[model samples]
Target: MSFDLHGRTQRLELSDQNLRAFEAVVLESTPEGIVLSKSAFYPGGGGQPADHGVLLWQGVETRIVGVRKGDDLHLIPAEGDPIPPVGTVVEAAVADERRSALMRTHSGLHVLCGVVFRDYGSLVTGGNMEPFSARMDFNLPEVPPGFKEAVEDACNAEITADRRIDVRVLPRSEAFAIPDIIRTATNLVPDDVEDVRVVDIVGLDTQADGGTHVASTKQIGRIKVAKIESKGRGFRRLRITISD
Candidate 1:
């Protein structure tokens, strides 16, 4: 399998975050899922959700409600939606409103992750996101005074700085060589994986990530630290939202 292939499908979204529409041939088709030769729909991971869109073929429209990852990337069609037959060349359009919001939200989380680690020296324990909101867990036993306001200020400062956000894939050995590639409390990357996709917030932060992000920190808009909670010993949760 080539580096660009996830199963039998060529994952176009990996190289092009701004891609929203593409044409592809159905290699396999069913109500459950459809496999295409090439697709730009992000089959989400790493705290991001899969993209939703529609497939157009022969004047019929089948809505893609979700994506299922397997040997091949499976575009999960809406229940009872018409499934394109194998070999059908369909025009696919990713739901821009959803994907764009997600791109901003995901990048916002990375900015938050970078700021927290840089200022507090806490490692991320876990994280998740939706269209414009997210929460991240950090391993910090003590809640510093004014921690919430401080993080929000720092995050927006970086966003205002308009730092570049770059994504690249490198061989496994080269990626881990960076000191902060794995900012998580524990390494989450699989040992069998031979390559690593890195998401770098210029000089602020770097991590081995496999999710879509904006072109720069400004594209993330303003990140609002909505709330903070103590889940357990050394576990602190920060809830955040993204706004224009």
Candidate 2:
């Protein structure tokens, strides 16, 4: 499912790429964690990992070890941590360095997917990433000779194009209308979902994605194809890493 923020409880789900910190009210608190009225933490989905950060209240710093419900629930592991009462206001911040790196890495994978599909007519079957590296699997009988070199050149060309990256939340009906939306695991979105979040590398690629991304291709800097592995029977996995 696209990580579109649910507006049900008035707690704004923070932007996956842009927001670094937020102020929120504690709607509820328990040993499990605290629910914020709003949050900037990315809950980790769509090939990206959950955000790491801290919540500050009354001079105590509580590390946010994990998150749930798309970042609505900021889970703080109990190590004698102070639990603020309901309605308490707190300052929430995500680790900026980590968030930024993840943003670039996530967008890089999208670029890889876009380039491969555009050039080879392949489709992404699955993918995963760390802060600065990722791997994407595609349905292909076998990678051609010099395929790695070809991909690296094409991807770099697009990156040099400095295309702008756009993110939008659209009505599910409108989102489904786009041809590219169906290319990337569109079925994974639930039928009950009324809205979808889209990430677009303008004129290059677009998909229903729910992760952080850089503002433009230029911000992604250099990318290297680290390795390729055969997953057997018409499947190949390409690994990539962001470099200097």
CA lDDT, every prediction?
0.93, 0.80
lDDT of 1 by residue, 1-244 (tens): 4557899899888899999999999999988899999998888888899999999999999999899999889999999999999999999999999999999999999889899899989999989999999999999899989999999999999999999999999999999999989999999999988888899999899999888889999998899999999989989999999999
* lDDT: worst 10-residue window of model 1: 1-10
Q: Weakest 10 consecutive residues, lDDT, candidate 2? A: 5-14
lDDT of 2 by residue, 24-117 (tens): 8888788677777777777777778878888889888777776666435555544577777888898988889988998889889988999998
lDDT of model 2 at residue 43?
72
What residue runs in model 1 are displaced by over 4 Å at the alpha carbon? none
In order of appearance, the predictions have TM-scores of 0.98, 0.91
